[model samples]
Target: MISKLNLENILFLDIETVPETENFSDLDNTKQDLWEAKSRYQRKKDFTPDEFYDRAGIWAEFGKIICISVGYFNIEGDIRTFRVTSFYGDEIKILKDFKNLLLFHFSQTKHLLCAHNGKEFDFPYIARRMIIHNIELPYKLNLFGKKPWEVPHLDTLELWKFGDYKTYTSLKLLTNVLGIPSPKDDIDGSEVYNVYYKDNNIDRIITYCEKDTIAVAQIFLRLRGDDLLNDDEIKHI
Candidate 1:
């Protein structure tokens, strides 16, 4: 089924997120209490909510998207290139720009969104954040009232699972095993918060996001029995 889908019709995306506040202390009294309740089960008795705050970005309610890098294929005669770009800076602007892209371009029935763990993470995360920010949900991102088969989002991780849902595989590991070039050359997910907040390196984070997006597309191509893209074939727009 994947082999039949056109690669150019899919929008490969990856997002970088960070806690809404730089530190736990920065949260107001009400938000701090809510954070405690939200994180209590995960933090356990040994770890306080504030101590576990570094991972706040995993939850849309507690965090905000800082960057969303997207890649898509373009063909001109016999030439093929994958153009990548990023929507970043102010969260509202990021969400708006991304929404606009979906509404204006990828809104067609055949268009789809692809990400490594998009079904479980990226897709839903973006939707939740958009609702939180009061941004209108584009047709591609809005899943409400849609049946499972109607959803156009694709998750490479789910495809890799192939009915074994008990375990998980990172994009990095899958790429390594499938012989696709690793995208983790700079940093992994664990360091994103620090890189964004402490080092203040948004460009570095954008690069990492774009790499992951390209890797997602590459992984999908590999799954479909196609050749992996060369570095020279990737262009940042």
Candidate 2:
């Protein structure tokens, strides 16, 4: 039988992305005119079914990646307090910094990177954007050519397969099911883009990302057979 993995070496990360908009100006007048003409095209149809309109609007406006907030439990610290580090700035710079931090942590210890829908969205999105920025991907983020089962990824959504693949569960829903209070009140993923663009508030984006990180952490705790946090243990972003 395979041994159960330890949670001490795991890293839980979450990223908020927006679409690329800088190159829109580089398009010729004809292309620009065409884009302008297409602006009224039903915005709803433009996004993936799983994506929210607010998220799509963010991509439509101020490009993507307003913030990435990461939370991890320090194994060395006896108290179970989670430490958080957030990057909020120019998308490119924040990505670079986040990537570096990930790489640095990986280099020091063998960690199982965990996220909610990381396998489908967060991981690939970060990799693609890194390639766009000509940034080197850390070894942990480089999962190209690996078979699905061979990759060391723990997507909570994927783990839910044991319950029912057909029944999709949002992170918030899973948190509640696991007896962990949801920390999604401050701002949601949908409002991230609008908060960054219309409201000019990157802090909201950070809070949103932080909540996701905590949610993922709770999921990780449950998977490890540890006592999941109750309402008292839950922290607001």
Q: Write the per-residue lDDT of candidate 2 for residues 48-156, one digit (tens) a residue.
A: 3223233342322324666777776645554455666788888789888888877777544357777897877777777777776788888677887877666666788
Q: What is the clash tally of candidate 1?
A: 0
After superposing candidate 1 on the true structure, give the runs of residues whose Cα lies further than 4 Å from its correct spot: none
lDDT of 1 at 192: 96
For 1-237, candidate 1 gives per-residue lDDT tens digits of 999998889999999999999999999999999999999998889788889999999999999999999999997887789999999999999999999999898999999999998998999999999999988899998888999999999999999999899989999999999998889999999999999999999999999999999999999999999878887889999
TM-score of each candidate? 0.98, 0.77
* TM-score, structure 2 vs. true: 0.77
- Judged by lDDT, which candidate is best? 1
Indicate the worst ten consecutive residues by lDDT in candidate 2. 53-62
Worst 10 residues of 1 by lDDT: 73-82
lDDT of each: 0.94, 0.68
